[model samples]
Target chain A: MTVRVLLADDEHLIRGALAALLALEDDLVVVAEAATGPEALAMARAHRPDVAVLDLQMPGADGVTVATSIRDELPSCRTMIVTSHGRPGHLKRALAAGVRGFLPKTVSAQRLAELIRTVHAGNRYVDPELAAEAIAAGDSPLTAREAEVLECAADGAPVAEIARRTSLSPGTVRNYLSSAAAKLGAENRHTAVRLARSKGWV
Target chain B: MTVRVLLADDEHLIRGALAALLALEDDLVVVAEAATGPEALAMARAHRPDVAVLDLQMPGADGVTVATSIRDELPSCRTMIVTSHGRPGHLKRALAAGVRGFLPKTVSAQRLAELIRTVHAGNRYVDPELAAEAIAAGDSPLTAREAEVLECAADGAPVAEIARRTSLSPGTVRNYLSSAAAKLGAENRHTAVRLARSKGWV
Candidate 1:
């Protein structure tokens, strides 16, 4: 039986090309395509594709949000997250949202189709490297205090100012900055802040 | 004309499955498969496939290294990076290394094959969403000094310790923390570090 598939991504060129690519597969049928998260969710509910390939970041709702909706509304239809961003946090969140497969856009076409087939077949699929990194990193790295301090640091705020805002002593704020820097393996607060922002931890 | 392809990734299941998937395509042939970067480079040189799909992080020479070698040796073969990790830094580096296409592993099997065809046809392919985020975030957000300070913080080093290590005054370290907080729009140093680490900016 041909596996019904749905494609969701905001890029016109990518979406069209992906549709064309999927169409080439004899056992894979492109049932629908959506450009945004809401459209993706709506299309999935309407078309009921056996599997949905979703990009994480979308126009209205994000992929995670859509995945949650799909799980609630169409429990049988599996969701495979297809995204360009491979942030560990994003992967963790995707898993938590009940996505059966997590693949990054950098994957080869052959692997992608295989993953889709695997996920559609009801087997879990995760990038081994990402799974390892996610396991190693665990949850958020920053302590509550450190995360607060780092957020303040990202804005170029002074320790004294951060201390005043967060009701911590200036010395305490400095300590938090020091701790955060240590956690990120950064040499200074500025570098720590940049690293945190990129990871979407903050 | 049949498009010759080379596969490089460590996972046996994925590597083998991908080979099988691509082999089904009448116009595509898997000429070589390698589990490591060094092997991939050697295979690419040996087979000289029309396209080379490489994983970013491998046991020995990683995807970027293989891409560089492929670009230098096989100018006719278009290089496409296929990795599970979607770190912007990796993507930027892959492009810089002369890879014509960047595909995340999450793409459908059909799309992956299509990308190979598209890229081999002299077109470029990248996850559009990633492309946007990369454009938005640009390159390293922190200055060299800030990165140094942040790395120190990641180690849980105290401000005095960081200052001592970096030869900066305590006041300078504090200043850097504040600047990072401001840039990251974080309320505290901890939050700044978390944000920076998430973005891989540090």
Candidate 2:
């Protein structure tokens, strides 16, 4: 049986390429394509594809939101999250949203087809390497405040500025920075930002 | 023949847990473990394991540095980048550093063992899902100046503060912020930060 697949990504070239790539597979058909989250959701609801290949950073709702919507509305349409980031938080959140498959964008076209098949077959598909990384990181060390602070830090904001925006005092911002540094055991704010970013905590 | 493995991660519990997990595999032996990048590189050089699983973020140097060291010193030892983040840039850099495998920490013990075995057997491994995400994201959208500005923003610094820290004029900083907002197509700085972060650009 041919698996009906819906493709959603913001990039026109990528979306077109992926659609063309999937067209080569006899068992897979690109039933719908979308360049944004809202379009993806609308298309999925209309086409009711067997699988939805979603980009997590789309405009409007994102892949996670689309997955939750599809899961809620069309249980038969399995959702596979395709993103450029394999941040543990994204994975955790995607899984929590009931996405059956989590694939990063760097996977080869051949493997992409295989994963779609695996997920469409009612088997859970996760990048084994990503899974290992998540297990190793254990629970996220980032608190909500820390995440907020780090997110601010990623853009290279200063303590005082972060404090003002977060509605905390300058000292409190420093404390948050220091606490985050201690938690990640980073020597400085730059290193902390880099580390947190690599871990997708920011 | 036992597959010798070197493990590197900062967390003591995770290091211990991973050691225990590897011990369960009959054909795999955990030769040496390091809690930081420098130690990881030193141990990897001293005791050449068949595979080195290095965490991307560490107290010093980071996993990419360790992988490069292993590649230079002990070419026989295959490097597997194991991290909590599935950042496309990280994966791209890991591969560039001659890492044979890229895995996130979320995989089960069985899958970890399987990837180790696969890499040790002269095979390359990457999480298919992650690869797809990376491809879809295309490349880092933030320009160097924009990234610098965003880094300042991550600290929740105000426009003037970020301008001072980044050595850009306040107007320029605001321009950068506005441009970043447009690039990520975000309505405001907060959403821009969130979107850039999800794509691992910052």
Candidate 3:
């Protein structure tokens, strides 16, 4: 039985090397490759690969967004995040997005191949060390709405613009921003956005 | 005369495509390819290509740092910055590092090939649109020390650590932070860092 894989990363060398390394497995076949988030989604939809390996950060989309899109569009396709950033916030987001595997770029090629097999088998795999740190870091402080607000703010969007984009009233947007700031112990909206981004909450 | 080129981009697809595109020209040859700044530097030092095309943000070393190293090690080898980030601050930094060309990743393959020839011929080239915006953005408000302090603060480092790293006293570090914050119209260190980053000043 062959497992089709979709590999997506902004870095060319890593993607090419990973694809080559995975090709060594007789049962694993690289069906598609993408360099950006939108491209990843498009390729996944077209190829219907059994497993999608993604880098967390890309030009058009982050891993969580790509995973969410894949899960919604292709429920049978499993997704994994392979990133250099082992931050708890990133893990939390990937988990929330229903990503089946969370592995760091530091993982050996053999471990990565094994994890791919595990994920393709309809099972979840997370790095034990990262999972422990995520547990110690606790859950994200921001609610889904608050997280959305902060993420929007991180782009330097104004209150009205964020409200419009998030489909909330301006007052509601302000409330979320203020609450998020207080929760993160940030002195202002910019600080809240920065802190939330650093924590991977947004 | 065939111009030897060193291409360094973290992404594999882009680098490969660019190399292929440039190879189509009669007198352009990609002599080396690298995925990280350090590797690019090493390859450039060894190959001493006529021109080096580098992505601005890469692991191990950044484009600015790599450019500086190449400039120091191979004084005759011209360098070009090929990046997605078109911020005035990034341009300023690249120019300060003595990069001969500043081009956006959106540039057509034809234009990029032409720019390489120009840069290799010892002429300066900057994307016209970016040059206009950079001129309109005016000069950076923060001094070298203040920019350094704000950049360090962005990492959530303590004032004492930043002071030690920058070889300044703790009080001096605090003063620079506060001044940078004021200059950027930010209320705190985090906000200052965010604003500075947005403006490409840090």
Candidate closer to the true structure by DockQ (higher is better), 1 or 2: 1
Expressed as tens digits, the lDDT of each residue in A4-104 for candidate 3 is 99999876545665676678789999999999999999999999999999989898999889999999999999999988667888898899899999977
lDDT of 2 at B77: 94
Residue A43, candidate 2: how far off, in angstroms? 1.6
lDDT of 2 by residue, A56-104 (tens): 8887988999899999999999999987668876787789888999976
Top candidate by lDDT: 3
Docking class of 3: incorrect
List the global CA lDDT of all models.
0.81, 0.82, 0.86
TM-score of chain B of 2: 0.86
For residues B85-187, could you state the per-residue lDDT of candidate 2 as single tens digits? 6787777778889998987665656688899999999999998888888888888777999988987877556788888898889999999999988998876
Q: What level of docking quality does candidate 1 show?
A: incorrect
Q: Tell me model 3's lDDT, rounded to 2 decimals.
A: 0.86
Chain B TM-score per candidate, please.
Answer: 0.78, 0.86, 0.87
Candidate 1 stretches greater than 4 Å from native:
A1-30, A34-36, A50-61, A72-202, B1-3, B7-28, B50-64, B71-202
Model 3 chain B weakest 10-residue run by lDDT: B11-20
State every prediction's TM-score relative to the real structure.
0.52, 0.50, 0.63
Which is superior by TM-score, 2 or 3? 3
Which docking band does candidate 2 fall into? incorrect
The most accurate candidate by TM-score is 3
Question: Model 1's DockQ?
Answer: 0.07
